[model samples]
Target: MAPRSAVLLATRNVLYVSIAGDLIVAAIKVGAAAYTGGSAMWSEAVHSLVDSSNSILLLYGVHRAKRTPDQEHPFGYGREIYFWSFVVAVQVFALGAGVALVEGVTHVLHPTPIAFAEVNYIVLGLSALFDGATWLIALRGFRRGAGDSDLFQAMRASKDPPSFMVVFEDSAALIGLVIALVGSYLSIRLDLPILDGVASILISLVLALTAVFLARETKGLLIGESADPAIVMSLLRIAREMEGVAHANGILTVHLAPRQIAVALSLEFSDELQTPALEIKVSELEQRLRALHPEVIAVFVKPQTALGYAEAVERRRGKTRQIVFHTPSPPGPA
Candidate 1:
């Protein structure tokens, strides 16, 4: 809806880069943990595994939301993006946070010895490097697309998938890497291997917080939130400007999706209007309304009063025309 070409391409690039990097890093972390016998490395590996899953889920949402509108869903599947994003959040909470918390608790209860401190550091460094590139690209996309809008509004209105998911996941991954490094270094230096598990707990907490935020937003969309307050005000103003419109009978706007809306309104007209002219007035109102609010995909206008005014005007015009026709014929004959 908004200029989507740049945003779409950026989204795709961000997805691929993040997915590849996360998956690779996850594998390396898991393997390094197994080889070095470091609980911290294991916790990070699990965190990355969940990150990879969340990225995949976001990609799925991006693709599904792009599907064309069908008979059962004439409004299009744009909202499906939010649905899939919700699933991603759930995965972050369930898979990432849940696993990390469990591992952290286990380490706190029963400590393990650290053997792969050097390897864990190397793996963490590599993960950070890869995350940096993905984050920069995603940030650039957000800057170009988000502009003055708030992040939630941008995500809500964005037709492009990458701008939302890629940016979020990449940012999370970068932060997670830093946290993992700190936990690992602390565990190795203090000879308190259980601290590695504590790192996992912290990662879990971060994921949970992110998931909760996303859940609240996505749930609002699923239940249907109102459009921007400004847009609603704009529509009301435009309706009041109509020539025959007494006032906007009422204005109702529903957010069908991030970029689409359905509007239904009642219109009260003057007491002395005519049918033919009323048709012209209706057409004018529709055109002006569309121009004022592009998100208004559909508008239904109902006349709030009886057609008495329009019918009276028609009757008056008919009588006037009849008298003129008769008068003109008599003059010619004379």
Candidate 2:
């Protein structure tokens, strides 16, 4: 199978597992909340339901992002994943956090005694088991790409949403479960039902923070974060090694999708090379680049003199810090 197809399959599988687990957990949580009249349990139910919906949206985003490039969108619809990811963040903040917060406040004001706190304990424990399993699945997928980095670093470096998003959701769910368990235990032990509502508020806070963080990361991608700096440097190195190439000026890149990148390279070719030779050199360079990095979907090459390349850089001066090779002096008399 193709690399992109494999990526889609893996992502879809993760989403499917999460959606199934959350639906089953949510159903049980709702029943427990209704039976026990526990605010935290109710909040957890909402959280699980929201998680299932978010995973579905992510699955859809993955599919939409797979659309083939056309005239209107020459780079394809890869950024669709980022856009939908942002929308998921909004839903978490608005629907998930908002509902939990409101429920928490109402419960605190009413201060009703929780019934059968033991039921909440059972439900939370089971939910944790389910959520923990799914979390491990997502983490394993993320770790495949993360190398030696920690989970937090991996999330920030990850270009794909479903990979890290599920991690974030399941992490919050697990933490929220612990808070519910503690709150349920304390509320019954201390005869303070308001503690249950406070626990719900904490869960809401966790969800809110997760949403904010997810939004910031997805926003960077939506605004077109460049591919890894390493990838950029490697592409320049490849172009510099070409036989007809005099100087590899620099490379420009943007991630069209997690695995899809569009690259533009500037090169100074040897003066004696005619049009036919230059075309062959360009084709050879592109083939080499794609062979080494299959993720680079398109490469745009520009033929420029050293002076022209310098002038182009000068025009864009101060826009952002740039890493570029010093222009080489013209070749000595042959």
- Across residues 1-334, which tens digit of lDDT does each residue of candidate 2 receive? 9877887798889899999999999999999999989999999999999999999999899989989989999889999999999999999999989999999999999988888877878899999999999999988887877888888987898888888999899999999999999988999999999999999999999999999999999999999988898899899999999999999888889998999999999898999999999899999999999999999999999998877777788778844435678998999999
State, as a TM-score between 0 and 1, how close model 1 is to the true structure: 0.79
RMSD, one per candidate, in order: 11.5, 5.3
Residue range 3-57, candidate 1, lDDT tens digits = 4444555666777777887888888888998887766567678777877777777
Total clashing pairs for each candidate: 3, 0
Give the Å error, residue 87, model 2: 0.8
Clashing pairs in 2: none
Estimate the TM-score of every prediction.
0.79, 0.93
Model 2 vs. true fold: TM:
0.93
* Residue 134 of model 1, lDDT score: 72
